[model samples]
Each structure stands twice: as C-alpha cells, then as structure tokens.
Target: MEGICFLPTFLVIWSSSTFIVSYLIALFEHDVDVIFPYISEIGAKPPESCIFGLMTIITAFAGMATIYARYKFVEKLNEKAGVPPALNQAAFWIGMLSCLGICFVATFQETTIIQMHDAGAILFFVSGVLYTTLQSIISYKAYPYGCSLALCHTRTGMATIAFLAVSPTIICVLLHRTEDKDYVFHLVSAVSEWIVAFSFIFFFTYIHDFKRFTLKLRTEFVS
Candidate 1:
C-alpha cells in the first residue's frame, strides 16, 4: 500500500529522464541545435528517436496509471466530502486524453509525420494544462479532506504557469514557422514547451494522499 505512494514519483523520474537522456544522445550526435531545441527535434531522427519512442511509450502507460490513481483518490475524497463527481470525472478523461496524445507524439516522428506529431503535441499541451487546472480546482474544493491548503495553492500555481505557457508555446511556434524560422520565437517556444511539460509532470508530485490507499485485485466468476 505504501509503495503505491511512489508511483507518481516514478512517473516523474521516468518521464523526465526519458527526455533528458534523449536530449543528451541527440546533442552528442549533433542531431539538434545546442540551444533550446524543440523536445521533438531531439528525437526526430533514428537511434535517439528509437529510444525516445520506446521510453515515451512506457512513460505514457505510467502516466495513465498515475492519472487513474489520482482520479480514484479524488473520487474517494469527493465521496467522503459529499462533493459532486463532475470535476473529478472530467479531469480523469482529460488526463487520459493527454496520455493518448503522448502515444501519438511518440509514435509519429516529427520529421517523418510532421502533421500527426504536431497534432499530438497540441493535444498533449492543451489537455495537460486543462487537466492540471481542473485537478487544482478539485484539490481546493476538497481541502481539509485528504488535501492541504498549501497543496491546493501549489497545484493552482503550477496549473497557472502551465496555462500561461501554453499560449506562448503555440503562438511562438507559429511565429517561428511564419517569420522565416526566427530563432527568438523558436527559443521562446521551446522554453515554454519545456515549462508546460514539466509543470504537468511535477503537479503529480502532490500524491501524498496515495500513501493511505492501496490497489488490490480480486478474481470473480460470472455465470
């Protein structure tokens, strides 16, 4: 049961390490620019791309597990507090969609399937920010019941940063593409993308409530 508490931590480590290792491999191989390359660019080619795709596929499954655990944790908290389940349910589905987006991004290489890769990136960032914001709201609403005010504030702050980063990410990427591949816009876009991605990752760190819960499997027979 207590071991479940580490799931979120594992997810964070695995996801962050995947990107970092891929980035280093791409850097050493001279596949991407030295300064603020888009995360996808680092994994756009072979070798690193293979590693990135495989690791990210695993990360996506871990993300789904983590998000589903959080959803159930919140569901229990809401049940205890007599809070409506609407927000929690919404957050769960959106979080799942973000994980699906990750699969798309991982499978469709940016250079090979640029359109699908870009679409996946858009879905991931947009839905991820929304999911975190909704979870933050749920945290505040469930305050004093398996959640602390400080945790609520922290989630809200992270969500705000992620949400703020999203607009600049999209706008700067578009600007970089349209403005003759302007380096400034590209840098800003890359920075914002990293911020948004990590913000979403770190938000799951507030899984202290998971310590008290355990997942169990039972066999059933149907007639």
Candidate 2:
C-alpha cells in the first residue's frame, strides 16, 4: 500500500512484534532442546499455523516498508555522493520480490505445496542477500559522506548476512543422507535458518537512522 511508506516505524514494529509473537507461539508447541523439531514441525499445528500465516502476511507488508525506506535512504545518500541508480533500484525491487516470495510461501504451506513453498523461501533469502549486500556496499562507501552507521555496524551486518547466505548450501549438502545421518543435516539447516532469521533482525537495526531520510514525494499543482 502507498501508505506503507508513510509509517516506516510502524512497519518495523508490526513486523517485529508479529514475528516475535508468532515465533513464541510456535516455540511452545514442541520440545525446546533440538532446533530441527522447531524448524520442521512447530508451525504445522493449530494455533502456530495460524500465527505463522499471519506473520508471513505481516512480513510482506514489512518488506514493502523496507523497500520504501531502503531506496529512499540510498536516494539521499546518492545526493551526498555518487551511488549507482541501478544498484539502488535493483536492491528495492529485488527486496520487493522477496516480499512476494514470503506471501507465496505463506499461501502455499509446505504440506500443500512444498515445491512452491521452497521456491518462495529461496527467492526470499536469495533476494535478501543481494539486497543487503548491495546496500551494505553503498553504506560503506557512503560512510565518508554522511551515513550514520558505524564501522562496527557495517562489519556485523556483513557477517550476519554471510552466515545467512551460507545456510542454503548447508541445507542442500546435508539434507539427503540416511535417517541416522540426516539429523545432523537437519540440525545444521535448523541452525542456519536461525542465523538467517536473526540476520534479518540485525539488518533492520539500521532503522534507527531512517528518520534522517527525508521522504520524497511528487504532487500535482491543483490550480
């Protein structure tokens, strides 16, 4: 929605709160010691299933908010320095595609459409990696200009993204062994998923400075 850009902080709160609550709901549904069970089993149940679906939908809106803010943030940076327009636009639209992927995954549950869900999941994570990597580069460059993020922020953000980006490979490598060995793969995948999830959280920490970005808009003369 056009209004999504108007309330960036609201989007952050909505997305963060919804995800935290939904995860809590799912976490309580099963055992706590193992990550595999949490990754694979928790969301398929009654209340958690509903919560998961709602969280997915909220995430879509949150993604929209992210796109709205991210490019605008870069647009301002571009004015201070030279940032590739293509890179900024690419980051925004690709991020949007990730949001669409989240919606697709939510609509088609793994039980009903595993292939589609997996595709969506892949889209979300892959696009997220590209979007973050591109913006991180831009931010690092813009640091000399006026970007408020500290060096540590950039370093941590990149590290978290790396942790997340490496996870799919782990899943692919370890997912197909025999039952005895498969749990190891599942555990790795589960850990990677958590890394990715937290990476997202870590990335959004940049929101603290978004208020410095002046919202750009166009209006027609009403004469």
Q: Give lDDT per model, in order.
A: 0.87, 0.64
User: Which is the leading candidate under lDDT?
Assistant: 1
Point out where model 1 deviates above 4 Å: 1-3
Instruction: Summarize candidate 2's per-residue lDDT along 137-185 as a digit string, tens digits.
Output: 6666667663556853664566556555556634643464444556566
Clashing pairs in 2: none
lDDT of 1 by residue, 15-123 (tens): 9998999999999999998888899998898899999999999989998998888888877777666546887889999999999999999999999988999999999
RMSD of each: 1.3, 4.1
Worst 10 residues of 1 by lDDT: 200-209
Would you list the clashing residue pairs of candidate 1? none
